[model samples]
Target: MSDDVTAWLLGDQLNPTLDVLADADRVLLIEAHGFADRRPYHAHKLTLVFSAMRHFRDDLRNRGHDVTYLKRDSFGDALGAFLADRPETTLRLMCPASHGAAERLEALVDEHGGHLDLVENECFLTTPADWREWTGEHEPGRTYRQEHWYRHARRETGILMDGDEPIGGEWNYDEYNQETPPEGWRPPETPRFEPDALTRETHEWVTDRFDTWGTDDLDGFAWPTTRADALDALEDFIERRLPAFGRYQDALVAGEPFLAHSLCSPAINLGLLHPMEAIEAVEAAYAERGVDPGAFDPAGDGTGVGGTGDTTATTLAAFGGDESSADTDTTLPPVPLNAAEGFIRQVLGWREFMRHVYRETMPELARANQLDQARDLPPAYWDGETGMTCLSEAVGHVREYGYAHHIERLMVLSNFALLYGADPAELNEWFHLGFVDAYHWVTTPNVVAMGSFGTDVLSSKPYASSGNYVNRMSDYCSDCPYTVSRTTGEGACPFNALYWDFLTENEEFLRGTGRMGLMYSHVDRKDDEEWEAIRERAATVRERAAAGDL
Candidate 1:
């Protein structure tokens, strides 16, 4: 109650020794009403963040820190309630990182008339000022390249290095990661931690308080909340799951949700584990077991995609999770082991680069119309009632698990959504609402910047698709009611026709793009008879979705 009280310790600032918590007195953690109500965020996401925050508060208490956890609907007015109850307290604050958060706290700071320090949230590797310096010089704005930036971070942080040279004789081994599992390949089962009483209590609180936030069937929800459980989950993945992860990382099989995925994103994002430590542990385990250095070895004796070795590193790298956590100066030695490297590239490289782009250009960036797309999202997106076997099955799984792998998300689900002309915003919202680990900072850049960014914010192209693209990547089409080869009428996969129409309609916006050049040539290769039937059927598919028929 004295004048030295620390004002607001935000939910997101869970990392100790960060600017927000350093040398604080009586840290006040707010469980606010207004911010949670600002948008229709998913109910499970609310549960995830809040439950994690409460567990963190208990941890701070156990560490002997004086903390007051408050839930208030009114901002400045609520300050009076705390002030009256504790007359000797002066507000000392570490300002919030979000624009909405900063603006709200600024009001409280002014009203309280005390010393408030705006500090850096050291959760990210690059600060806002660091990104601004790099971005200020480019024109028409250059997209952030994940590998180039990642290499720079590697050098600066001294990760994966051996005497100023990268370990493994290369900076990357993405070439080896792309081999698909042989037909009838069975992925090892993934680890799932059951929810304890604490998680259940948190779920009940979320349901009662934020009832209208968003909806999902929550019966199968088992995510790690405490630091202890998170560590167990990480160890389980390293020992039982990491080896086979590279091969099936992109694979889609019916009734299987966590094929080779670490499923640790929620824990890492919520500040339960550090990226550097997790990556190092994985590398150490592999080395200890003498995992065949060539297990994921991208350079084959001779065979694979484009005759270019194998490009699978993107799959493995994705697990370091997002870089905007309390990451350390540790990296697994460069594996160049195909799938592993590709996976890491996505998580550490592409993921971090997108965060830089989003922070530097959001609000305006969020509104950009890369493809000039405008259409209502289809009913099946929420209803989970689509006639297509793959889509219906995928959506239903997402509804139940609040999780899906990257390939399932970008290539399968988002691919079909784009083919159907589903509104970009709608898809973005749906993903954010349904996924357990979803956060605006993460999902916005992923959906808006990567999946839908025809302007190439993070991607060089829009990731548009035809059914053939799906068929090659997954076995889903094998059991579906439609054929990938059909271009029109009933029994054709809708993706085949809609793909051409999307390219035809957007030719003016996309023709000059080098990637689109290939798709355009493919479209032109279709004979007159084939093209006419496609036009008619594509039109019907669009009309049906627009009218809420399918």
Candidate 2:
């Protein structure tokens, strides 16, 4: 409420943490000029941001502080105007998520001649420095995994810990979380906030200002745009979704877009929800009871529509890995160990680890193309025009809601990107524009390192897969025009040939990897004639995708 200093808040940095909002006299919120125009950003993402910023700004003014918001063509122009309007002001900012962003902000501050102070982002579980400290113990090499980094995070945070040891006697619940939803089992729906005037105005503004890729309508738009609503979403998740979340966390169901996933990423990444608050809320919700294992199945017991199908190991774990079962408990937890540990690993371990990995790799990650993939992102990705049910379902969801479940993201979107040989950087940019939660820090490591393996880091092998993997994990393949069993010729799944061509092209690079041995063995077994058929068909798939004939 004072008029002594100015707090400059980026659109994403909406959290009013005490550190970021320390004794500020006023707040300066600017909508970067032509930001959405740079890429075909989802209109829903823009509305969520603009409406949230307006709400935050209005909240500040309601508390008696002056607020200055400039929706300018350029940030430089906004800052110059602000400097001229208000002299003798020091600009305080929480550090931007990417280095490039920080540099741009810094240059403006330097040119304007006002003192600038930058503090670490409070949204993350840990800072880049903290991540670097954690990595210091392990010698830098090709073998470093997020699991080790995640364990270090758990120990440091003392979350889900019984003194020095983990409470469950195991650090991961990934294996237990992979249950497919039972047929006719209805999943719970995520809460959708009705758009008010601010959101409506922002939607119209976005629509008039730019023509973007995603649907611009506000129907079914229900993301949290205020702190109170964000808290409500968090409570809703813990109370309703968290229980089933751990078990069906990886399941991909048609028409069930959010199933058990928290849907809290938008709020947290935007700074309305803090990481620890969510972590603690979920921990508290856990009905950690001493129960009989026979009576209570901790990990849903693989009870899908078909009594018990063959539990084939898929590569979903590479992105979100798993832990071995513990020796201590014959008894099950009130909340399944998989549910509790899976959520804990994501909030405390994986999210923090991903952010740090992005910071450490940066500009190099932006260009990291270990696979040397140079093909254009297929028009099917943007238009949802393909006959493949999996692509249509996933891409259609992204277009309509600007969202997809993590499994769909990995098994469907990212897996296809890896197999199709799309450029990592361009795909990374597309992800940034497409998703509501995407930021430079979040997208680069996820898209390039984890999703595409552009960086010669994270996994030793790229997250490549065929239609068979998708068929096992989802119903999308079941409804597709192509067959999962067919790897070549007419009506064969594109992923089949693309998956083989990927290995054939990168056989030399993959031969050295220990984990690639299984896939490599399969590659070796194929006769020369089979390889020729695969390569030829793969070429046709790419050509059709490029020409929009598919």
lDDT of each: 0.65, 0.76
Alpha-carbon RMSD, each predicted model? 7.5, 6.9
Q: What is the C-alpha lDDT profile of model 2 across 372-415, one tens digit per residue?
A: 98888989889989988888888888888888877788878888
lDDT of predicted model 1: 0.65
Candidate No. with top lDDT: 2
lDDT of 1 by residue, 319-420 (tens): 333334322321222232433444455556665676676665666666665776667677776667766767777777676667778877887678776766
Residue 442 C-alpha lDDT in model 1 = 75
Clashing pairs in 2: 2-25, 193-222
Cα-based TM-score, every candidate:
0.84, 0.90
